[model samples]
Target chain A: MKARVTVTLKTGILDPQGKAIEGALKSLGVAGIASVRQGKVFDIELAGADPAQAEAALKDAADKLLANTVIENYNIEVRS
Target chain B: MKARVTVTLKTGILDPQGKAIEGALKSLGVAGIASVRQGKVFDIELAGADPAQAEAALKDAADKLLANTVIENYNIEVRS
Candidate 1:
């Protein structure tokens, strides 16, 4: 099974990297870009066959190590 | 309009960050995790209503700034 974890900054958090990206895009002559929010993605391969178990384990992983729950939110997707 | 860009390391690339994440997950007692790959995601808001134009601009941004074309692949999704 494969689990994808997306960890994104919560609304109202300041993202310096995103701001830098927005500026870079503008300097690159890309127009109409208003804002950018940067995040992290983790693609994990598991040795399990049970989708439910994999999802649960990934969620645990996200909560424990993959995300800063105070400032970020994480979503998990499982594929088998 | 909104565009989401995902930047991932190419296959066979050494990802020290991903390796560290894998070790962290194991230390956190999360089982069944075989391997981990880390990537970046950017959620971009654009000032245009045209999906086609937004997609093109985002692709350009990805190629120029969001991704390293030599070692990373990027995927863009546009929403309106």
Candidate 2:
């Protein structure tokens, strides 16, 4: 089974790294960019075929370690 | 317009951060684990609704600033 978790900053949060990227993009002549918000992607290979169990484990992992829930939000998807 | 850029390290590359996270997850009692790899996600808001143009701009942005193409591979998706 394969699982992916995406963690992103919540709205109204200041993202300096994203700002830096946006500025860098403009300087590189890549126009049409208004804003950029950066986040994290985690790809995991699990040992089971049970989607429900895998999703539960991944959600727990996201809550416990993968994300800082106060400042960021995380979503999980499992594929078998 | 909206675009998403996913940047991930290529295979065989040394990812110390990902290794550390894997160890952390193990310590946190996240079982059924085989392996973990960490990457980056960028959510971009563009000024134009043209999906093709937005996709091109985001791909350029990812190539130039969002990702180090030498060690990383980036995927770009544009949504209108």
Candidate 3:
């Protein structure tokens, strides 16, 4: 199974990277960009085939290592 | 309007960060782990409400600044 974990900044968190990207976009002549927030995505391929187990393990990984819970939130999607 | 851009390393690209994360997960006792790949996600807000325009602008942004076309691929999703 494969699990995709998307880790994103919480609302109201300061994202300097996002700000920089927004500025870069504007300078590159890509118009109408209002705001930008950056995040991380983890694509994990597990040895196991069970969807439920993969989801649980991915959630554990997210909580333990993939995300900073105080400032970031993560969503997990499993594919078999 | 909102646009999401997910930037991922192309196949056969070396990802040290993903390896490090996989090691970390193993050390943290998450079982059945195999391989991991990391990517970037950008959540963009557009000033315009038009979905078509937002998608186009986001694609432009991704090509110009958000992604390295040689070693990365990006997918853009627009929401109004």
Candidate 4:
């Protein structure tokens, strides 16, 4: 099975890196760019796992390292 | 509008950080976790912006700072 984990920052958190990226975009002549927020995606391959088991494993991954849990949230999707 | 940018390593990239994270998870007694891939996420609120504009802006941000482009890929989602 294959799983993808997406982790993102919650709203109201100040993202200086994102702001810097936004400024760089504007300076590069990329118009209409108001702002930028950056996040993470993780794709993992799990050998010999059932869908339900893989999802549970992915959630465990989220809790452990995929998300900060302090200022971020995570979601998982499993594919055969 | 609000936009979220997700950046991840392309397959075939050796992610040492992800491997370390996976090891940490295993040590912490989080069972069933076979592997882990670490990535980055960003979220931004664009006041008074259209979805299309926000997406284009996000692509520009990706090109500038959100992604390495050499070994990473990025995806964007916009919400009103």
User: Which runs of model 2 end up more than 4 angstroms from their true locations?
Assistant: none
Clash-forming residue pairs, model 3: none
DockQ of each: 0.93, 0.93, 0.93, 0.54
Taking the tens digit of each residue's C-alpha lDDT, what string does model 1 give over B19-71?
99999988889999999999999999999999988898898899889999999
Error of 1 at B58 (Å): 0.4
- lDDT for model 2, on a 0 to 1 scale? 0.90
Root-mean-square deviation per candidate: 0.8, 0.9, 0.8, 2.7
lDDT of 2 by residue, A1-80 (tens): 99899999999989999999888888889999999999999989988888998998898899999999999999998878
Quote model 1's TM-score: 0.97
Ranking by lDDT: 1, 3, 2, 4
Q: What lDDT is obtained when candidate 1 is compared to the true structure?
A: 0.93
Clashing pairs in 4: A37-B42, A37-B43, A38-B41, A38-B42, A38-B43, A39-B40, A39-B41, A39-B42, A40-B40, A40-B41
Pairs of residues at least 3 apart in sequence or in different chains that clash in candidate 1: none
Q: Under CAPRI classification, how is model 1 graded?
A: high
Q: Give each candidate's fraction of reference contacts reproduced.
A: 0.94, 0.96, 0.98, 0.68
Score candidate 3 by DockQ: 0.93
Q: What is the lDDT of residue B64 in candidate 1?
A: 87
TM-score of each: 0.97, 0.96, 0.97, 0.77
Superposed on the true interface residues, model 4 gives a C-alpha RMSD in angstroms of 2.9
